[model samples]
Target chain A: MDTASVTEQPVLAVIPDDGVRIVTVGLAVAIGVAYGILHWLNKRSSEESRVGAIIRHHWQPGAWILGILLVTLALPKYFTIVAITALSLLCFREFSRTTGVFREKTICAVATLGILLLNFAAIDNYSRLFFAGGALTVALLTVCTIPFDKPKGYIQRTALGTMGFLLFGYSLGYVSLLCNTPHSRLLILFLLVAVTLNDMLVFLFSAVGPKSWLLPHTSLGRTRIGALGALVVTTVLTCFSGMVLFDGTPLAALVPLLILGVGISVLGQLGDLLVAAIKRDVGIPETRPNSPNRGGLLERFDSLILVAPAYVHFLSLMLGPIGSDLPQRVITGGGP
Target chain B: MNDWDMQPAKDLHLTGIERSRSYVREAGLSESLIRWCWLCGLRNWFCRWNGLKIEGLENLPSEPPYVLIANHASHLDALVMASIVPRQHRDRMFALAAADVFFENPLTAAFAASVVNALPVWRKGNQQVGLKQMRERLQDEKSIYILFPEGARTRDGNLLPFKPGIGMLLAETGTPILPCYLNGTFESLPAHQKFPSRHPITVTVGQSIDSKQFQNRKAGWVELANTLKETIQEMSGKPAPEGLG
Candidate 1:
């Protein structure tokens, strides 16, 4: 008998699969189908009616839905940061372009570059100190808006400047928090999916429901039916997504998240309305002579700014701190 | 060419100077190049420099066979007009220039040819040749003729009497005329200064007037000329000339 035991086979360990890969693929397909259907419906609706006329009459609720969908689809993680940051810059640039805020409106171009740097800071979870600095810079800008003689103009500029900072700086800071969280990539995806669903539902509701003026004075005026529909849809989607992604979360924990989603959606709509009101008050035409129609940047991103801080606050409350080891179920209202 | 022009119409069997078609062709080429350059460089600069207060630019036509009649106060008036007219229509436009001034120097003459597309006119002498050339240019469907009907810069920076030549050209062509009022050019580059000073200028374009309305009226060339002067004066918020009713 050979001492080497040539017939003996080496033992190999069997790897058990967690089934995450399958679920991710399924989620992707579902999102793709939903987007395709929505796109087709939007196209069909536009063909049936004049888009401009429809928008002028009832745009707010639809805009809110569209904005939420865009934010949700973006995910706001490291990979999606570039896209989100680009949008943030565009929104701010458009706001400045339309409002004619800076003395040399060209300065907005440079400020957009600075925003990219801010986005980087946000992603690394480097320091809250940088965000604090940004807040201080905004305050200084507001002070600079003070007029030598006209107090009214001073106050107006200060308000406008402060709003710009809140929208561009503070709101955008949440994206950094998203990047820094443990399993941030997964959480961002969940948020994006939930928000997108919320946006779509809101849009559908607004389109079909009875028209009632939510804000009669502002350009982003919405109907009571539209608002109610948005809240219902957002809550349902948030709760549903929370259940599906997180296995151990309690129903009681989810109520706050649902409320937060509804509140953010409503506030976002109000921000859009505020921007439109500003343009209307200023009497700046949506289009300039020999130029294409660009309704101004501030008008475009009004809602995003309003919702960003609230989103950040909600995340902080749920997750404790951005870089902590809190499980997804706990952070997203899925766990007890 | 000079010898050929000296021969009498009877001997040559010619009917007047074969109305130099070359002048129109030359005008077209010169206007195009100058207009292109000005559009590329000077327009944006002028807009920035003056803060470009344009009141009624939309009223002007995109294509032109119309007369652009404006108040002339300084040499800078032409520059301002060139800078202000929409870039699209610049190439087809011509400004009437005094032969004694712009055409005298080689550099000035070349500039006048390329950029201004200047139609040189003798202010005093025989009006027949100048008037004939102007009328022919205006008659063309492709050309836009600009004339400072006051004939010369105003001494007091107020508009002078309307020259009869403008009325004669208008009567012959029956083209719509656009009245333009230029303010602050005199301060920017006053009549007496050689170098232009930095001053903001405003170029206001008034509504276009149809020549058909005045076509058959008893208001002969002189009366028509006075009417034009009055129209421009009213648009500019200045008083009409003293003696004209």
Candidate 2:
């Protein structure tokens, strides 16, 4: 692929304008089927057990997520980017609140501002500025909090702030950047549906498989077989979906599709584990605030945090640099 | 190097409305920012609207592990108490608000938790358990609590008898208690008034009482409450009513 060709203007459009309609419908159907199965199992299962009863209530949030996904598909590109930015900030708020980093008001303010700027760069289609966010965030988090003159928890707070910046600000902000791509709407839908399915499959597989722990300490209930099960299931599901979603592109080919699917599954699980690891380090391994072992937005979207960047990079490599054809510097109105 | 012992927020397990109405809800950076801004505006509001004046700020403790108790006459009393402290200590200041009144709904709960940084104290729930959590949070997090020991706003503009709940929080701890009286706030926004009317307000803060001086029991707490109530009544420049104590 000629990476330079990505800058060329007005390439004949291939994908239909309403191309995501079928994929969105497919995703809704998939969620419906899963919900039906869960409802069926919940009916048969005894609610005397705590797990059985709580898992029965899973459809509440499942319906909520489906509603959000459907609404996002209907919105404009900028709306999706703004929603993603808001998600990143809310997820960061959860992390900071959970890890005791919220105590440092200054560090949190800088991290929040950094997250907003990253998304702003993505909105502007200024990839260079978006790429520069990681360094800038760490630098600011380290330097800006020095005036407090209370160095007691300096290292801890700084480290927490940096990690939060990297995870929510830089990493998760990629979802906003992905919106700058030609295949943004369908692509986001594809990733969201796939990841949600992957999580459900992982949980389902763990309940029945050889009772084993993925990392006994980090996640109290995650099974090794469940992780492997999600990897295999998500790979196949995402690969088939990618064929339809990426029809006009080379990514529709079996080999590239398979690679894309595997990348997403592996990276998604790793992201989930990364969040699990943080909670473990902070002595709050698993919190069932609403659902069993499912926590706030951070826990729910942890997988998406990593998969977004990886998918963007994969698309950039397969098809030229992602979002290159889009108007450059929408905010600054300058060329690279 | 400091030992790596990272204690999460006390209410880490709670989320959303549950966290907001939680008695142990700890305000985060966002809430702190909102609270700071709210208090700053409130300071200006008190001064300009009510022509607010202060008598003894020098009597407040330099650090936390202290409680501020004042006669509750109107809704303005809590805001007045919270805004009196310096900006540096604003983050640690939390006012104990009546759960039914302030945290009954989402909009009011958000305001109570974020802007006011007030924790819900259920008047009819398990008082001992709630007070234990509040007391522990005060000491562990180095917090300053603004409490209205009168239990509820006075409807008739007469001071209510101090409840022993305040002593339950300070018992066995050396946390100093600052007795204060807010003159003219009842007239500004009395229990009957839906909205505050303009009235000059003057707050007189007495020196802290070593809570350790009182016994850590019901009788001792009652005695402590009466003593502080007497101090505040004296600050009101009212003659001690006979047989009230």
Q: How many residue pairs clash per model? A: 7, 0
TM-score of each: 0.45, 0.91
Index of the highest-lDDT prediction: 2
Scored against the true structure, residue A305 in model 1 reaches a CA lDDT of: 63
For model 2, the superposed segments whose C-alpha errors exceed 4 Å read A3-5, A9-13, A16-24, A48-66, A220-224, A285-294, B104-107
Put down candidate 1 lDDT per residue, B75-179, tens digits, no spaces: 877777776666666766777888778766666766676666676777767977767766776675367777898888976777888876676677735687888
Candidate 2 achieves a global lDDT of 0.79
List model 2 lDDT by residue over A1-336, tens digit each: 554454553221355445456765676577667656655665676654423443532333334544664587568877777777777788788889878888788899999999988989988999899988768888999988788688888899899999888888888788788787776777677778887777666666775577788888887556899889988977887776666666776677889988887888788888888988888887764645344334567667788878888877887787766567788798888686
Query: Which candidate comes out best when scored by TM-score?
Result: 2
DockQ for candidate 1, please give it.
0.02
lDDT of each: 0.57, 0.79
- Where does candidate 1 chain B have its weakest 10-residue lDDT segment? B6-15
